[model samples]
Target: MAVQPSRPLRLFADYLRLERVNLTERWMKAVFNDADLSESDRLTHEQLSDHVPEILGEIFSALEDQDLDEVEPSIERNARQHGRLRWKQGYRIDELVRELDLLRQVLMGAIDSFAQGHPTFTRRHEERARHFVDEAISFVTLTSIREVVTERDRKIDEYTGQLERANHELLLKQKLVGELYESRMQITRSVVHDLRNFLNVFAMALQMIARAPARTNAALALANRQAADMKTLVDELVEYSIVLGDNNPLATEAFDLRVLFDELVASCGPAIEAKGLRLVHRFDPQLRTITTNRLKLKQVALNLLTNAAKYTKVGEVELDMRAHGDAHWRLRVSDTGVGICAEDQQRVFREFERANQDDVPGAGLGLAIVSELCRKLHGELRFASHEGEGTTFEITFPLRLDPGG
Candidate 1:
């Protein structure tokens, strides 16, 4: 027996077809204009609009057919492809879902708008159309999400395996260098402690995603930020481990002091701005070039500047470069933040020690790493702090580092 499509649905599908071009334009505008999809700003119109028109066409066809069975395969294939393309475009899972959700909203809005204009679109007709449209959009959403999840899982597994192997080798080497074992253990305990604190916040954000659907975007953003912070912690830990394990001589090179500080200032701009703080820097006119391990120098300077920005709430962070003497120069980082108390001042250089860990967002390794690198570069690190005033960290280094130094 031949089954006939519903006349009302057929007419509604025709209306959708007529408005498909307009709907696609609306979807593109909605996505690009959305603040949550800032990543799309980097993409061109053609790249962002890929496969969207086709997806709309599938929806319209399914509407006309009065059954999704005829269009489900096409929808799945197109959606999977769209998901892969978005993945390659650096779209996060939340962002991928977000864009499509916007599309669904656009389609729903169009359906309501159409129903309002047509006297024939009765309450029953609107209900049937809404249910069908929702089903079609759900199919696309689930298929695309599955594709993205599969790829992400595969990449995570591969990276996890590589890290495991690297960890095993590192453990063997650490065992041979028995002196480094205690330092590494301190770092591990500190990392675990900080990670537990971060994970608690992350889990709470995930839990809120379902309980408060209105805040799903906010929750997802929190999760992404937490993940990024964790990555930074792991990277810093690896760099610290390398610094600890290294016994080789320092690598010396000549680099411009002004250029180095300029880069540091630029890198610190975003963080400083986010907290509504100012970054002020000055370089001695006579200090043109210095012969030293520029990389280590920059690392130490950056760690200090980053720490300054992190702790300062209402005032400016300053970086001052001055010629200490004919043979030495000093780098100073001053911040108007909650200064270290007299009691906690002695432990500032110790590994995994923080005066206010509960309120701060560091793994407590910045100054320790700064102290270690200062010794390696033959630089002397000194600081002055007052409980309510602020803190100043100054490192004095020789203008030229000899191989033995």
Candidate 2:
């Protein structure tokens, strides 16, 4: 004979199908009425009622088929939906878990009501009801926690990306501010040093005129020339300040390189003679007139030649101009003087930085100004030196020629 179905199993299946709607209503009312579930209660009735009926239908099918697989997918999906909803709605995880606990209580209460109304009810029926409800609750709770963890990790990654971008922007701003500060300090030091030199010359001219009234005309001429030089220095300083804005215009012209070299040598001859050092110059035969900023180039040559004369005592200071290539020329100023030490070489191109030799009368702005001017002219300046031997500065610039000149 075939065995009959168990009474408790049949009764449980009948209870799930017939009482599913009523049980869901009771659970919703309990959650909304509870003071501890204010966040869930804030949602509309339709939103709060979402997925509850489907979950009940899955449980009912599982009971009828005697297979938990019938309800597994529904349980996992409902848990994830609830986890995401509560997160968006500002509900705590513990509060959502509490609502699940209330669902179990409502289901068990309905089972007890069915037992109280039926005459054939038994303890076995209660145990089977508890088993199904407990299993469903455990699966949902675990899945919900997993979804919450995923959402939290995603938020953390977004926050980290935002912080990294902010840090990068802050570092760029700091670098730009530091560069501006250094530029301003360099300009101030150069102005002060150059003005002091011009003022000294002016003062000496006035003293000579007062001491020798017979030569007043000659002294007055010297003072007038010194004043003109001061004016030129002021104009140069203004040009440099505007260069920092990257808008200063270059005054280019065609000038004979040989003539410029001769003028420079003659201008500095007296200083070289006074220091008892020889001045030597050599030029490549192919070198000729070129088009460039003549005044700026002259300033560069004058500064280099003056520095060479100030340092050298006995040996010669040599100036050489040669054709570097088809498109370039190199100017070299080499001096047999007290050479720069290794530690001082690194800072020699910085404004107001001098070598260890303090006896040399200089404000330490010559090489620094040369470096800046080279950059403005789109050229390169390099040097080699050894203590007690010599120093040589070489600059290479593009050979831009004028057809008209």
Candidate 3:
């Protein structure tokens, strides 16, 4: 293998860098000083600024020329310019001289040797110089554009994710607060009804005792009646508190409708009697083997029935249950009460809502609890009513009883 001369090559590359600098300096100086000179001087300055670089580059073809003697005049003219106008000032022109010398040395006798017909080293040196300048410009442009694009994409991604997170947090807070307000309203309505019922029963008992002829009978009856009324109110309040727990766990079980209906009717008699309304319940005993949380379902049923009794005036309140299939049943409660207005129907399920025509006393969660309970049992509920006529709530509960049993 032939060994390469590395030191000669390094000097050769430096030579090209200085050559371009010298050419650039001459071109700028000629443009500034000779822009308005006389026509002949203008021609001379244009050759120095532009035409000379082209003539010198002709060395590659000059090497192929059979007569290299004719190119001598141009080279000698360039050499003379380097000594006179090109190398005039000590401070300003010294830079041009240094550049010219550096360029001449890095040429490394290539042009001279090529002119002397040494073609082996010429093409290689030309390629090396062109590649260095091209690559340097390309690398700088690519680096700057890449940095700008990368930064823009990063900021866009961060902003999109930030907005999504903010919206998610807002929805979560809205849901939590709504659940809280619902629980408080349910508790308030339950307390109000229980309190009123207790007071009414107490008043009835006191009046009966006050009319008694004997002191002994009046005192004994008063104490007993008051105790029973207090007990009933306490029981109802406890059940309401259990259902009103925001995170309460309820038990589902199988129960007969005949037994459940009788208990509900007897338990709610005081509240119904106080409102001067009659209560009616209709359920199918054969299809009543339903699997549900008996206490919770009972609470739901009683609340609906009681609300009907409280709202309706001079009309009968009815609770009716029917078997749809082995898989589900429909429980419909209709009242001859003040019907819910169409505009207020949607808002009736909202917490703390009371209609403008709603003359009854109850917080607005009776239907909301019914809706939630229906969801827990995999059921569906709907209602229809006419204004001032009556309202009918229809619920379809899945039959959770063992189908194959």
Candidate 4:
């Protein structure tokens, strides 16, 4: 009650099964090695040769069964594998489609050659062969396209994920930059307020000195000290502003470290005297001349000295410097001050954070500014402290700095 495949269809199916290896070799030779095919030449024999023989065998089996369903699963699996491999190898869709077309052509051509050589080849057998080839091509083409689309969608998803991550990182950087700008503005406002107060005091001291002839010497000395204090405050504000600008605040030059040390010691003399704290210093002989940002380094030293003088009540504040090697130097500023508590130490270097010491006359920008300057100069800042006993801040500086900076 069932119609069977014609004589040639059965013969052709048997031939395909027996000649699959030969057909695969011919396909590789004709298509994969073709110079006209871009990127195909880059693939090895194993890469180009995979799944071809299996595809041929599946088509032959479908012909033997005289049913397309027998081969459909194999076609889908092979097509998917082929599409993924081609995509990973950077093959274009057009090139892969062309390769599939060539595969069909080579397979039919091999079958046609066998039919031509056989004596029992009839018109009915040829028709059956053409039908089998057409059905195989149709199924393979549809499956190949489906696989290509799936792979393309996968790639799009992967690229979209990467773009999203990059966008997230950019947003975080923008937020950090905005916070830094706001902090700088706040520091400027605080500095301006202090400047106004100092200027008023300087003006009043000047007027007193001018009016009082009996106490002229003492008045003049007071006026001179106030003027110096005002100058120092102005200098600090200017340094901070420069550091925030486009150009590098560090000006590298050969200078005597001892001279800078002496200047800082003298500048802190009034504060040290007022606090009743002894100031002691030691400098390494090798710390004479070097290439660095002199003003920025001096600023760092002054901040450390001022902090020590501000906090220390009775014992001594010591400044020591030593050559770590030919390439670097180390400086330590230790004070017998009300040392920072463990919990407060972490917050001390952040802008407007005063380590729970609200009694100290500062907007909490001193150490924060110092920390920033240290970063710009490619330096390291570290500290050791025990509450109510003492604290020591250490800094290390490189000899040769970043030229591109």
Return the TM-score for each candidate structure: 0.53, 0.54, 0.44, 0.58
Q: lDDT for each of the candidates?
A: 0.85, 0.77, 0.57, 0.78
Error of 2 at 212 (Å): 4.6
Worst 10 residues of 1 by lDDT: 1-10
Best candidate per lDDT, number?
Answer: 1
Candidate order by TM-score, highest to lowest? 4, 2, 1, 3
Question: In model 4, which regions exceed 4 Å deviation?
Answer: 1-99, 117-161, 181-235, 249-251, 254-275, 286-289, 355-362
Q: Which number leads on TM-score?
A: 4
lDDT of 2 by residue, 195-278 (tens): 787788788878888898888898888788767766765654555444445555666787888998888888987788788888
Clashes of each: 0, 0, 1, 0
Using lDDT as the measure, what is the rank order of every candidate, best first? 1, 4, 2, 3
lDDT of 1 by residue, 1-405 (tens): 123667877888998889888888898899999999978999998899888789889888877777788888899999998888888888988898899999889888977887888878888888878887788888888888898888888889999999999999899888868746776688778888779977997999979997998999999999887887788778777777788788987789998889987898889877887899988889899998899999889899989988888788889999999898899999999999889999998889877777674556666778888999999988988999998788999999999998694
Which lDDT value does model 3 have at 301?
82
**Root-mean-square deviation per candidate:** 28.1, 9.6, 19.3, 8.2
Q: How displaced is residue 216 in candidate 1, in Å?
A: 2.4
Total backbone clashes of candidate 2, pairs 3 or more residues apart or in separate chains: 0
Error of 1 at 23 (Å): 99
The runs of at least 3 residues in candidate 1 whose Cα sits more than 4 Å from the true structure, single-residue gaps closed, are 1-184, 210-214, 357-359
lDDT of 2 at 22: 82
Tens-digit per-residue lDDT, 1-405, candidate 3: 123434433454444344544644544454445433322243344444543353334332232232234454554444444333332222123333333333333343443443245344456654543343233223322332343344445657898899889889889989988877775776678557656765775677666667764654765576576566466556544544455554644466887867887787778766666777777778776575778777667767877787677677776788888898778888888888778887888767654454454334444456666766666656688889888898999888777833223
Q: Residue 230 lDDT in model 4? A: 65
